[model samples]
Target: MPPLPAIEQPAAVFVARPGTAGRLGQAVSWRQLMVWPRWVTLAGFAIVVGAVWAVVLGVIAGAVLGVFCIVVSTGTALIRRGLTARRIMRGSLTVATPGMGMASRFGSGALDIAQANGITRLFYDRVRGIHVDRDIVVLRYAQLFIGFPRELFPDWAIELIRAHRAASGTTGYSANIPALPPIPPIEQPDVSMVADPGTAVAMARESFRVTLRSVAILSAIFAVLCLFLGRLLSHDHGLAAGLGLAVITTVWLLASAVRGGPKTRAAYQLSMPPGEPLSARFGSEAFEVRTASARIRHPYAAMTSMRAHGPAMVVRSGGIHVYPRELFPENAITHAGMVNKLLAK
Candidate 1:
């Protein structure tokens, strides 16, 4: 049998400049609202601001202040979006494939993205998922997210991309984009490895430890501030008791957060039902978690951090996913190196 030719990078593909109104709309639509951390931070901000307002004025004033804060946040987000859009419009944004992976350049800055494996570029694997829409083409690599303008590439380039995706054994469908044509199946690498239940528990514990420490530090700072404020104000007996209660409650909550990690780990174990072992796969484009009855795919971009923790590969993105050395004794080191390399790039 003849060897297949390597897939070379495509030439630079320029994105069409959208009108001012259209650019503004695109900017607003691209907001990171889907990212959980953004929402969590916003909620925290609201709580702190409302509490401060309530203490200064009254309940009604606090409610009004919260509403005003939310409105201001929304407006500020829109303004930032407009600024980003204007920046993109002013710069020359182009996409290219330097090799197997995709690369995009805006003005002087450029982003190079590819899968984790040393042998295969994400574009050739077909196993990694790609989503195409009228406005964007979102490519999922092992460690990065690449969203480029759909109209940036010509029809031929789009067809070539679809061809690669069709060849990959992906079974998903996108409603917003045109349906992809089927292609011959290619052999897929075995990325899935069954993980030890004990490892999962340990990972959960570590995650909780980090969270608890953060909360404890913040709580201590807040308690100190409250005490200082009480001293500054008239040290009434009732006010002192209230401040004492607040400190007690904060300490209690911090303790609970510390204890919650193990409980959460136990809950995860119960949810898994412990019939067969849990298996995880690292594909060209995404990560897959499989159980006896079901499988779930998570894009690599969804993972925020990946690093070597002793003999394990600890990933914290949407949640905690730990790959222990016991499971992949031979490949754990290699996997860690690849992840670190990707992250470094």
Candidate 2:
């Protein structure tokens, strides 16, 4: 292996949803809801203004003052947005906006109405003492490590922060779009080393087979219920029945396809070393995969720290962080442990 490039100084750091696999290929999970307080406040402001009205001088004056306060607050937020953008342009850190980031960067699993109102950016001066290389912003908790106090934000509010950053152009903006960091050399711990490609393949295959079986069973059960329940009726709604079944089948197929993507990828790559943790490269000419798997070459110089997000792993490098959960199977833990053990060698 060749020597990796040295990192430069004065990098900015921000949090984002996990976009790819990070350290150990784990991803974080953050849920976002629509009815969170921030959005509720906005909605309530509207309702209160319309339904509850009073003619007393204090009541009218109070309402006017409240409205003014809301507007001023929103305006101030926009101003902060501009300042944040300036930080990005200056190559302080990378900011990921909506649709951009690690999976758990902000709204991990769900993003409903309330979550859309409160997401914000988190800033970090350094991740694990490594200077961030770009001005990348993340959709989730990018602002948690910074300021006088570290604040943990809910997913919904995080989404709103993203919106504010995007509208201000400070979010999702990367300065000079920092180049990908060089992969770091693996630090091996003392441990026995072995690569069991066959074992890995078998595991992946078995997992996929189980998933397929379950999906098939569910499909059949649902299909029969749809057909049989409708058959009991004597009405001439046969056409509607047929159409409904078709729709159900279509939906099931789509869901199954999406649900199977990771499994399929794992199965296809099963031939590679499995049980001992494997290092492999994936991607076309466009980009490369990042992970903490010891068998894999994690040559990328990660500016941020490694956060083990449940089944997912996160590595913040430059303007973006990678999440491994979206691509790998749930058996990642076994693989990760194996990789870590090997790297220990």
Q: Rate the local accuracy (lDDT) of all candidates.
A: 0.44, 0.33
Runs off by more than 4 Å, candidate 1: 1-200, 234-246, 258-263, 271-275, 292-294, 308-313, 321-345
* Worst 10 contiguous positions by lDDT, candidate 1: 105-114
Task: Identify the candidate with maximal TM-score.
Answer: 1
Model 2 regions more than 4 Å off: 1-172, 176-186, 189-214, 235-252, 255-345
**CA lDDT of 292 in candidate 1?**
32
- Residues 1-345 of candidate 1: C-alpha lDDT, one tens digit per residue: 112122234234332443423442353346432335655665676567557656655565456545654675577566755664544333212112122232221111112221211111232332244556666665543322345555444554455555555755222222223322111112242444454556556655655656776777767765665455445443553246336635654765676676565555653353244344555555544554443322334445444566665645556543455544343333533554365555333
**Model 1 Cα shift for residue 264 (angstroms):** 1.6
- Compose the digit string of candidate 2's lDDT tens values, residues 128-184: 111111222223331111210012233343444444444543334333234323223
- Over all chains combined, what TM-score does candidate 2 have? 0.27
